[model samples]
Target: MSGHSKWNNIKRKKEKTDGQKAKIFTKIGRELAMAVREGGSGDPAVNSRLKDAIAKAKANNVPNDNIDRIIKKASGEGNSDAYEAIQYEGYGPSGVAVIVETLTDNRNRTAGDLRHYFDKFGGNLGTTGCVSFMFQKKGVIVIEAEGLDEDEVMEAALEAGASDFQSDGDVFEIFTEPEDFSAIRDELAGKYTFVSADVEQVPDTYTAITDPDLIVKMGRLLEMLEDNDDVQSVWHNWENADDAE
Candidate 1:
């Protein structure tokens, strides 16, 4: 398995062990709020960014009522929460490039927490663009393979404007241009239940950490980033020894 799938495995375990579903709602809520401010509209029909956010929330199993409520509340007055989207780039143990995407109102607190986690776990947060160049932003959509024909899924995804498609025996992955993500996802939504559909930072390369000590520290570094409330998504290029083998 690739590191992305391995990390998704870790995330799945963590979410079930804790109340991470509620945390996911909060993160998507912040995204909806920010999308309204950035796009200056509550109607997803007119605001493409809001449309994408709504789709993402829905794909992740957020209730339609909650999505509507968040957008409506954000469009009204007296809502003082303005989330700024900031990305932190860094190098983890074994020089694995890490990029943390966050939506937060308090930059200082977020910065301090992220810095502390990196420093404590043998990683160092770097300046902007320090590690981002090693990555590319892409729209990735995943669908479970159970009770679904692989060929049908592949055909549908391709017909819906997906640039590439792959299956790992248990799930199908669909890739598209960032601009085509929303439309392609919407098209597939009519036919399949999405495992996840979002724009993600994909690393161009992977760094394999075979040393057991650095592997444990890297795991800690990832956990700290994942547990933070302000963190929306954590992207890295670290490959485990098992994957390397």
Candidate 2:
């Protein structure tokens, strides 16, 4: 598995704890709110972004009741939070490419915190397009491979419009074109339970850091970024990212 997928699998395990789960719920809630406001509708039938956000929330095991409540609150007149979507590109230890996606009410505060994190952990935040050109946006869906037949899963994914299928010993990953991600995910949803279902930045190439000190700093950098309330997703190109463990 790639670093992005591997980290997500690790995060999935971590989210089994109440504290981590609550943090994930809060992050997804912000995403839901942004979808509703930007898409201009609470109804998933009419709002594609909202539909994708709800699917992502459900895949993360968010309750149906909570989903409905969030949509309702977000669309209500009483809700006035104006979150802006921002993308930050940077390099981690040994030039490990990193991309962070955030939704924040205060741009300055978010930028400062992120800058501080990078500097504290032996990395530096870069200009908007610095590392982004190294990645491609793809819809990635992960399903537990246990008790599942590889051939069958591969066939189903290909038939459902997945561009590629891969198994990383623990889970099956299905890749889809950005434009076709939602449709492919919906098609496979009826038959398979997802560990993760979302469009993500996928690195075209990967790098590794061998120095132990740099490895620790890289791990801390990622940890702080993920724990930030404004950060929704973090993608990286570290092949030996498991070293962070």
Candidate 3:
């Protein structure tokens, strides 16, 4: 993980086409709905999960109207979309550990599509615990670093319960234990704009694919998984993923 870059990943997502942006919006909407259901409240103040989901939606440029509408709908009766959270662990090319997180109403369809993608790209989907051992879940908060003072931000983050802080090229990454994520994020939100705020599966180590063919295949595998509507997040241990992007 020596060269891992979170800012680069944010830039890539921001540069995607409008169609892709729509998919992202849809995925976040699903997240909002789930948050409301799981938290049993539409009010972000009372429902921490819904508050965190709203922050993530805003960071991705989701409009206020859209966010409110989604929450209202999710809280209302007659909301029938029942999405189950599923995590699939596997290996990408060259033994790179991969984890795909999804929210799906139909497990059969999602599983089959993911299996095909992995197989076609020289990887294979494995059991639930197959590759998850290599990862730890943490809350990640990113703020743009254009004019912010790193020392000030780091101090505030640490004081607010963040466990780690790093300044990437164009963003500051603040990490916290999963349990402290919401509190820290809410504290920082009062003063700074977020680029992204969400709990994520972070890799413990990194792998690099030296073979050109495997590199190409690994890239495609990730793309396919990300493009799927059911997939909420994809985490991997590819150290050179910045180059692939």
C-alpha positional error of residue 48 in candidate 1 after TM-score superposition, expressed in Å = 1.2
In model 1, the runs with Cα more than 4 Å from the true position are 1-7, 10-18, 241-245
Scored by lDDT, the top model is: 3
How would you encode candidate 1's per-residue C-alpha lDDT over 1-245 as one tens digit per residue?
12355436534543553377788888999999999989999999899999999987876678999998999999999889888999999999989999999999999999999999999999999999999998888898888889999998999999999998988777788989999998898898889987777888877889988888888888888877877899999988886623422
lDDT of 2: 0.89
lDDT, candidate 3, 92-193, per-residue tens: 899999999999999999999999999999999999898899899998988998999999999999999999999866888999999999889889999999
What total of clashing residue pairs does each candidate reach? Answer: 0, 0, 0
TM-score of 2: 0.95
Choose 1 or 2, whichever is better by lDDT. Answer: 2
Query: What are the lDDT scores of the predictions, listed in order?
Result: 0.84, 0.89, 0.90
Ranked by TM-score, top first: 3, 2, 1
User: Which pairs clash in model 2?
Assistant: none
Error of 3 at 153 (Å): 1.7
Instruction: Tell me which of candidates 2 and 3 scores higher on lDDT.
Output: 3
Q: What TM-score does each of the candidates earn?
A: 0.91, 0.95, 0.95
